[model samples]
Target: MLKLLSTTLLLSSFIYANNVSEKVEDFLDDKFMENPRLKSVDVTVSDVVPLKQLAGWNAYIVDVEAYLKAQPKRLIKQRMIWFSDGRIITKELTDMQGGESLTDLVKPPFKDEYYKKENLLFGNPDAKHKVAIFSDPLCPFCKGFVPGALDYMKKDPKKFAVYYYHFPLERLHPASVHLVKAAAAAELQGDKNVIEKLYHVQINPQERDVKKILKAFNKAVGTKLTPKDLNTPAVIKQVNRDLDIANAVMVGGTPTIYLDGKVDNTKKKYLKVQ
Candidate 1:
């Protein structure tokens, strides 16, 4: 608390000193990135600025309430608890920077009403249809049919929505999980065109470079993935989340399609579940 107050005072004086100088204001704005306390400070600046003058600063007020709220982490935001504080412990993803934060990436709060051009479609997020999918990338059957089921949007257009859930049968296909991760990474990259393609290409038993796999996987589905991106904490965490979701659902087989949001064990195909 003492440290925070001291730093706050220093920053305040800096801002106050620049109140009369345009050049000084520009210098501080450029130096804003160098503030070491930025990530730790729970602070906000609020003002309704005109579009034309939005870029100019020194007019906003410090939101003290917002600052007070920033002191404690949200429950969901409290994602790590390593060895009870020894290491960063995470349930959804271990290697990602904002693994939990990416919940909006895996499934957004407000989904599309019509067929989503950017996102996958199944049951109507708005209307009479609700759909679910049980899929594993290592399954040949899933690789062959799951994409077709998603393509139904071409025939039916709107009036329904779709949700995809991971179902990895570790017993039957031991390597399926990573393949699913690669696909999830692609899906996250907004290259739906190549996600399924990655699954299909990687199903083979041949071992190869992880980078090469990511590259080939991206190109096949009409997406481009850099080798650098594969190592990102976000992608790794997402892949781990897929594994967790699969374990939660206990899907025994691949391509176990569900329709209208119901998880029917006896029904495996889309229309069959319907």
Candidate 2:
């Protein structure tokens, strides 16, 4: 391997003896034009060429390693990234911010109250920050917001208050209604910590004994209620409120979230994932 590399280097040196820089550029240009492997490389280059002019997009932050390696001086926020070295790597961009906008948040014209008043549901009443989450009980997308979301909150609990609501696509999964109802009922038991656990952890409806969920709910979050307590009228009322809010918000699917009401349909704000 070492001898082959040495021979290639010697041959390249001989080929480029007089016009080294020109020869190198011509070689690369020819490779760029003719090689299919280089064609794939061109795609990466075209995707990022906008960066040269700083005509940005929301996808520049993806493939942090490739972006960093390809353009050591650049800072990208969204989109794909790639380059050839001795290794290969890539990533899909998330968390879009608009082009040429230095601020992480985009300005929306309406007051947050507009979205909140329409969609807000089960959460701590006195909580400072509000997040409305639309989730199907049985959907994997909804389940993605689990322990990861909790960890995100732990960073700054005071700034993150999540409102859980069910947008169960019951026609698709008949079992979703029961799970949504149980989850809503769990919320009223006054321990969001436990409710979130049950929301995130207990997903399987078949093996899901109501007692197991209630047990995990109890053990993880120390709620002040028996399973029967969730059957009360007040709990029923709370569950109804959650469903009503989910309906009002036009929650189409599970795991849809409005962040502080700033990211929603009243405005055309594209959601940035965590």
Candidate 3:
């Protein structure tokens, strides 16, 4: 009788959680409707990551996809907070002592599976330190930092293993989506220097057409890859996987760095890693 009772409670809890998530999604949809610029909006909540419980509230990191009527071709991805006291939902929470946002305080930790061999951009896999970077090729800050980090890994290959993941800020750099896809395709074709070479490629950031991006990519990377090459199932899958991992890790911007499975806000922690 006790076993059956426990199972029933578990099921009820699961149902309650689902209901809360649905309500959060609806709230976001309604909120977006208030924007006059967005004629119509559809909000899809992809992941509701639970965080440490506050005094009587449950906190969640809500990953949202907002499809706006004004921009049918573009999908906006955003991360928001949801604090619930069972009946009421609030959007923001902060730590009073340190003034840290809940999102920063409870960001998910890196999983071991994230350190895939295919994502390794440089250095020995078994090196003493593992550095993972979520970067956008077109982001000026990434353009400045990534190459220098790669150089450090190259110089001391045994000291650090660097892995690169694509986190294209499509809204800011419309061209980066294609560039990242092209880089993935190049990697599939055994191009070792494609990632480094791509930073130097002079392509218009506002350009969105695939053909033009491919033309520039091929010329600069010295590869004759066509649009079909960049759109192959393998290349598409690789880019998607990288983006998914970036989302999972709550990477909001380019050049988000991780050292030994922890967020490195300064992004230069690897320099001191012995």
For every model shown, what is its TM-score relative to the native structure? 0.46, 0.43, 0.79
Q: By TM-score, how accurate is candidate 2?
A: 0.43
lDDT per prediction? 0.46, 0.46, 0.82
For 179-217, candidate 2 gives per-residue lDDT tens digits of 555555655544454445555444454444656655544
RMSD of each: 17.2, 18.8, 4.2
Candidate that would win on lDDT: 3
Best by TM-score: 3
Candidate 3 — which residues are off by over 4 angstroms? 1-26, 29-54, 63-80
Worst 10 residues of 2 by lDDT: 58-67
Q: Write the per-residue lDDT of candidate 3 for residues 1-274, one digit (tens) a residue.
A: 9999999998997787778877877887788788777655665554455555465465656766656676867776666566775678876778787777776666777888999898998889899988899999999999999888888777887888889998888999999999999999999999999998988878999999899988899888999888888788999899989988887878888889999999988887887876
Write the number of the candidate with greater TM-score, choosing between 1 and 2.
1
Candidate 3 has a TM-score of 0.79
Whichever of 1 and 3 has more lDDT, that candidate is 3
